[model samples]
Every structure is written in C-alpha cells, then in structure tokens.
Target: MEGRLENGQYWQGWTVEAPVGVVVFVHGVHEHGGRYAPVAARLGEAGYACYAVDHPGHGRSPGNRGNIDGMDTTVAGVAALVTMAADRHPDVPVFVYGHSLGGLVALTYLTGERHPRVVGAVISAPALDTSASNAVQRAFAPVLSRFLPDLGVLALDIEAVSRDPEVVAAYRADPLNHTGKIVARTGAEILTAATAMPARLRGLTLPLLLVHGGADRLMPVSATEVVRAHAASPDLTVRVFDGLYHEPHNEPEKAEVLTEIVAWLDAHLPPAPA
Candidate 1:
C-alpha cells in the first residue's frame, strides 16, 4: 500500500497473487503515482503487478513541490523501485512504464549506466522537448536556475491534460495534483536531459514501446519520432493516437491504448513454467 524509501521518498504500489509479470510505473510531474490506480487494476487483472513511486517533490514524497536538484535524483528513485520489485518477484519479468515527465525518467533509467535490467519499457508522451510556447522560459532557465532555482516558472494548463471534462475536473480537484509553478532548476534539468536524449537513446538496446498522442499539445508527436529514430532497440514500436490529447490512458480511447500495451507486454512475456 504505502511505504517510505531509505532515501525518504514515499512510494505506493499494488500487486496480485502469482503475478505473471511486474511493471514499475513512474508518474508525471505535478501528479502523484496514485492516479494510476485504474490502470494498475487493469494490468493486475491481466496478471501483472504494478509498483510506482512518487518523485521527491511530488505526490506523497517530501520536497519542495516541482523542484529537484537534477534529473539524476528522479532516475535513481526509479532504479530503487525497480530493485525492490525484483527482490519481491525474482521470477517475474519487470517492465517500466512512465507517462509524460515520468516517461523521460524511465528512458533515462534504461539508458543510464549501472541500472537494473528490465525486460522492456513503455514511454507515453514523454516531455522530450520544451513546448514551443515555453521557448522563452527555456532560454532563461539556466540563468534563473543559478540565482532562483526554487523560483516558480510555469503553471500546467489542466485543460491540456486530457480531452475528457470529467478527467479534467478530477485532476483539478485532486489535492495531490500539484498546481504550482515549475521550479527554475527543475525546468533547466528537464531541458538539458531532453536535449541529450537523442544521443542517449541511440544506446538503448532493450525491448521498448513508445506511445504518444498526435494531438498532444504538451509533448508533440515529433518528439516520439526522434526517440524512435535514434533508439537502437531492435524491437522498438511507436504508436501515435491520432485524435487523443496528452493522456491516452485517461482518454475515451484508453481501453484501446491499454490493449495495445498489454499486447506488447504479453508478446515479450517470459515463457511459462512447464
């Protein structure tokens, strides 16, 4: 249910008996890991256990909301959770799934050195590049990070999160869904990581699936294209949902998206015991 990492980060997860596989999920910025309960339930029904950790400054974890010293902290946090999952279910294959900002962290974890091994990965609408509208902030981010690292930069426009009005309302009402400004340091780190992602992706050799909404206003489909083109993974698959917004998991076509994910994961499943 709930636990604290030795690093003092708060983590939450759900599991099923005799799971066929495991998935370590990482949530996006300004949102806690708990929002994926429904998605986890679907995966659980398919015989996959799901574990997720709230990033340092987000969710139930303690830190300045929307602030992190660097992306390494987030990457390390996900690696820890993967290790925990492996310890608990050594026989089951573990897959990492990340949405939006979490997707960037997941990719980083896979591409980074000295990280835990996973069977495959799912990246959904990763924030690989700064939105065109935020170009000014991206330009000034470095200077601001040095002087006002904690300074609030931009507020997420909730409407851009999903096409469903109900989902929008719930996100707006969710207390854990942070509505604060993105810190200067966090912005800079994200921009830096995104800039470096193309080269980093060229070295990723694991089974991978990249999903994105063609209509997503935040992270454009072109970002996913870059990842697909550069990722050296022999089994990389890219799916672009034409009309959906940012969160396909919350969109009206979510069932289709989930089906696609389950199918990909199942194809890569470790062989059944005799």
Candidate 2:
C-alpha cells in the first residue's frame, strides 16, 4: 500500500488483481493523493484499479511544505507512478487523471519527452494559465523566488474549492489539507508552467477529456478552452459544468462528473484480452 520512489519520495497507492483498467491519479496542490480514496473506490467498484502518490512537500511525502524545486521533478515523479501502474497491469490500459495543480503535472507528463505510455488522460480544473496569487504578488514573483524561495505568498481560499458546503467544511477540518501559504518558488513555477502550457498542448496527441467548472474562480473555464483549441488530439473532449466551482468532483453534482469520467474511460479503453 505504501512505498518509496527511486528518488526517495514516499508514496501510497492501491491496485486490484484483475481490473478492466487502471487510473493513475495526480492530486491538486496543497493536498495529498489520499484525498481521492472515494474517487478511487468508485472507480474500483467499476472494475478499475487506482493509484496515486503524494507530491513532494505535500501529504505524507517528505519535502519543504508548499515548495517544489522545479516542474520537471514533479513530472518525473508522476511518470514514475505511471510506469509502476503499467508494469503491474501490463494487460490493462492505464489512464491518467489529474486535478488542479496535478492537472498541470499530468499535462506536462503526457506532452513531455520522457513519459510512460497511457491510453488517455482526464484533467479536471487544470492550472494551465492561472496562479493563486494576486497581481502584485505575480509581478514580484521572480524576484521573490530568487531572494526568498521559501517566502509564503498566497493563502488558499477554501471557499473557492467546491459548491458543497460539507466538502468545504471537510477540507477545513482535514489535517492533511494544507492551508498554508504558497512558497515564492512554487508560485513562480506554477506561473511559468501555466504560461508555457498552451504551446505544449499543440504536441499532445493523446486522447484527452478536459473538464472544468464554468464558475471555477481558481482556474477559469477559459483556460480549458485554450487547451482544447491547441491540443493536437483529434479525440479531445471538453465539458464545462455551468455552476460548478474548482472541484466539480466534490460538488453537489459530483455524480455527474464521476459518471462522465467513468463513461469516457469505458469508451476509450477496451477490456483486456483473455
């Protein structure tokens, strides 16, 4: 259930013996992969195994909280998980699902030079062209990153997470839910990745399902539109929930979102050979 990456990062995950397929999940910033247990459970009941890993500096993994040295490291970490899943489920296809910051990592992994083979990807509220910080903080981010990489910049807005009041309350009460400020370097990296993501989308040929909340203030629906426009994949699909917030999977209409994901996976990935 728990192990360490070759790079020494700790990871927690689960797998099934004979699954129709597997979903490798990459969670949002300031949150560990464990939060997806419910999502994983739902997928598991559908005959799909699931795997997730805490990003460095978040969850139970070891690192300076809320800080990442570079996006490459994060991409590599996710790629490693993909490899692990593929190795364990060689007969079954694997699909990647990323939310928020993890969505950025998933996108990067799918488009990057070195990446594991996967059937498709599901991105939810990807942080492609947005940062949590305000204009003032954005303007001075580079200088702050160089001088004080660890300096705390922006506090996460809990209210922006989901439409469900209970989900918001649970997030606030969860000890693993990082409520801390974003570090200067982390903010800088996020901005850098967001700015560079569009050009990268042109190279992504993998089947993709990009989902976002039309009312998501954290990462707007417009960002997902940009990705859809440039993505080279002919199989790309986009779904914008009219009144949902950042976390549609945690919203009141979560069943619809989850069902959409499952249906997409079922359509794309055929059953493994006998």
Candidate 3:
C-alpha cells in the first residue's frame, strides 16, 4: 500500500496475512523505499509486514533532491512511520531496519523519547563517520551549510556499494537512486548527528543488532564497532561479513545476511499472548 505522512510525504508498505510483527525500513540519503521491495517481500513471506518512506527530497517525495533541512527532520520522518506501523498492527511487535544514512536516523530515533515503542532494530552499514570526506570538505561543510546548504560537496564511490558487478550496474541504472554529490547541509547534519551518538548510544537498552561488511569502504566496519562498543543494549549482536561491500544484503551471499536477520527477528519477538 502507498500513502502519505501527516506532512504529505509519500511512503509504501508490504503486508502479509496475520503478520507476526512489522518491520519499517529507513533508506539512505539518495535512495527511496521502493528499492527495498524485494527485501520487504522476503520479510513479508516470513510473516512480517514491512514499510518504507521516501525521505523528504528523495525519490517521489517532494523537496529539493539531495538535500535535507536537518537530522531532526529526518528523525521525525522515521518517527511518523514507526507510529503508522504500530497503529496499523496493534498487539504486534515493531522493528526498524535502517541502512547507511537511515541507520543514523534510526539510531537517533532509538535514542529518542519514542524508542520504547520499538522492540528492536537492525542497523546496517550506519554512516556514523565520514572517512570519505576530505579534510577540506569536512572543514568547509559546516560553514558552507550555513551559507550554501545546497552546495554539493562529495559523491559516493558507487563501486564501494557492492562487490557484485550486477548490483553496481543496477544501482547505477536506478533512476530513483540519486547519483549525485552529497549536499553541504545534509553532510553537516549527518556529521553532527553521528558525532553525538556515542554518548546517546550509552542510554540504549532495547534489543539491537548491528551488521556491516568488513570490506565496506563507504561506512567502515570500525564505525559499527564503535556502536557495538558504546550501545548499552544488553541484547545487542554484531555481525561483520568479511570481504563484503557496503550492501551486504545485496551482495552475492545475501542469503547469509537475510537468514541471520530473520533468525534474530524470531528471537526478539515479543512474548506470545497469554
């Protein structure tokens, strides 16, 4: 199903009959929720409902492409979908799956006031640090964001996305994917938000799973290690797929990641009815 948020931003969902739980996906900076259809469908077949929203300024959503007002706005967007998922499937547990930039947003939301509503979350290749940004880009981003927020500063290394050549080919061909430089303000917001997470992560007590590719160059596995180190979640699990690229789920060995995710979800499901 397709719908709009209170702010009229577009979102989509995939459902299954008598779902055991709901999983909401938060996509990265340049991509839309539609890219996750196959992954969501898999979850649906596993008896879990899944939903995703095109972040403002992304995909079919209305806004200047490749830019965002702030991380607060981004986090609020995730909050809206989380609420929608819970309202649509009351009595069923809800989980969050965030990749890259979305992972940071999900982390911010989990550390926020409404996190208790979520049972657990799967954080994949979170953008917790910007190692790719040159010293000049990092130095200028904040000042530039204040002045020319729309200025494009850095572009992602497309080859770093996945080791599978076909996946890279599809990503390059996907019209919905914004293959452009990261805007100044968006870059600033992501950097600022990520810088604040280590402290906030210490407060997280909910069940959590962090996954990443050991060979990922975009968002390094070390950043995820930092999350594993700081997150206070007693039930946290970390999986590092050595030699895989950024998108482990899209990697040739995707089943390994998906199977682990499903197993984790099964283990974390809320208690059955009395």
Say which candidate scores most in TM-score: 3
lDDT of all predictions: 0.87, 0.85, 0.89
In model 2, residue pairs whose N, Cα or C atoms come closer than 3 Å (at least 3 residues apart or on different chains), thus clashing, are none
lDDT of 1 at 7: 90
TM-score of every prediction relative to native: 0.95, 0.94, 0.96
Error of 2 at 223 (Å): 1.4
Q: lDDT by residue for model 3 over 1-274, one digit each (tens)?
A: 9999988778999999999999999998898899898889778778999999888788888777888678888788889998998998887999999999999988999999774558999999998977777778778888999999888888789999888999899888998888999898899999888889999999988888999999998998878987898999899999999999998888988988898999999999978878
Candidate 2 vs candidate 3, TM-score winner: 3
Residue pairs with clashing backbones, model 1: none
lDDT of 2 at 75: 84
| Candidate 1 weakest lDDT stretch, 10 residues | 110-119
Best by lDDT: 3
Clashes of 1: 0
Give the C-alpha miss distance for residue 11 in model 2, angstroms. Answer: 2.1
Give the CA lDDT, 0 to 100, for residue 260 in model 3: 92
